[model samples]
Target: MGKDTDIDLMLRFGQGDETAFRSLYMTYRKKIINYCYRFFFDLGTAEELSQEVFMRVYKAGSRYRPEAEFSTWLFKIATHLCLNELRKKRYKNWFVSLDSEEGSVANQLADPSPEILAVMEGRERKKKITSAIRALPGKQRAAVLLREYHGFSYKEIAFQLGQSESSVKALIFRGRDHLKQTLCGEFGEGL
Candidate 1:
């Protein structure tokens, strides 16, 4: 069979095509997992949450609306799910331990080759940037993640978050300011 388009694959999956569902799963799995990882800072939890997100998609297939872009819809779901998780964590007084075994700072700092080490250091710096992002209020974090990590335009993020584009911009601005304050000590004046 010829390769199916995303819309066609989604339609087939909605009609109970197992192979089509598998194809969709294979296509977006890594992206979703990475997105979740960036939010939670835990590879295993991200993997589990990614699977859960897909499960939700599978279950909602019959009601899936094509009015919005598929990716926008997918990210809306992911954003809500991650926000809910964060809220629960907050209510439970739980925090992502800095000492978690999954890709901690020490591991990131141990690169051998100088060039690779520099690249790794850059990644670590970005991780710190993201860590400051996580420390923002929920809406700010969501806005920053969607814009910086997913490259979503303000209008798209506003649509996904059901906010005005100006609101999205404000959230992003506040997020950036918070990150700048948190990172200024390390990055110096140019941050």
Candidate 2:
């Protein structure tokens, strides 16, 4: 069978086609899951949030408008949901853990060079950087994640976060400055 286009699938799904909705879910699940994973640093929570994101989409399918690209709308929804979760009292202290198993994997993937290992303590440096990112305030962290990690334009981030583009740029600048300070303190000026 031929693959249905995104707009076509979305239109069909809006008309109550379950199969089309499932197809849409299958298409974006990994991206949503990874996005959540990066913020929460917990696999189980990320998986749960991914399911919730799709559930929200399924419920709101009838209201889905095509004014912008489907991805823009989808990311707007995901960003709001993540912000809500971050605001919950239970997660007020949800900082990323440097000693977590996930951190170890990230460290391993970041600096795989044997020569680099010989020149520097790669794993320890990676952990410090990760911890510094986690130490940032939520807005700064979100701005950094969306722009640096997700490759969002400042305008796109402003749309997602309901801020002005200038504000988004400021947040990103502050976040990067904080990261730089933290990394430099831990790994010296060269890092």
Candidate 3:
């Protein structure tokens, strides 16, 4: 048998086809999960966020118009949810622990007895850059992630973010400037 097309699956699901919803869910689950992970830096939270994102998709399916590409629309939904999550965390003053998200800085620094101090300093500098990106305003962070991490065009990001193209560009530029200043501070003199 052949696979159903995206439009067909969406149409069927809109008409209350549970199987179509299941099919769509299975197809986009991983992408949504990874997208959320980019924001939350935790697999368990990302998984939960992905499920919620899919639930929103199912609820909004009937009202969805094909005016935009399904992939773009799906990402818009995911980005909005992740941005909202960040806002909530900000209001609560909660810090996202990126400790387990990557290799330990400790482990890298531990065996630094032989290697030049500059290489280990570079690793620390990278961490500062990552943290500075995280410290950006939610929209700015989203702008950076969409453009740099996901390779989205300015037009596409502005559309997804519901902002003017100029505004999106400004956000990315300001975000990058902030990261640069932050790294400069961390590495001293000529970063």
Q: How accurate is candidate 2 locally (lDDT)?
A: 0.76
Candidate 2 error regions (>4 Å): 1-5, 94-123
lDDT tens digits by residue: candidate 3, 1-191: 13337667877888888898788788778877877876666688788888888898889778866656566667788889888888774434545443432346546665555455566556655555656666677888888888887777888888889999999999999988886786676667674
Per residue, candidate 1 scores C-alpha lDDT tens digits across 14-44 of: 8878898788788788878887787777788
Model 3 alpha-carbon miss at residue 10, Å = 1.9
Off-target runs (Cα >4 Å) in candidate 3 are 1-5, 16-20, 89-129, 184-191
Clashes of each: 0, 0, 0
Off by over 4 Å in 1: 1-4, 90-127
Q: Considering every candidate listed, which one attains the maximal TM-score? A: 1
> TM-score of every model?
0.78, 0.76, 0.70
Candidate with better TM-score, 2 vs 3 = 2
Clashing pairs in 2: none
> Per-prediction RMSD in angstroms?
4.8, 5.6, 5.1
Worst 10 residues of 2 by lDDT: 97-106
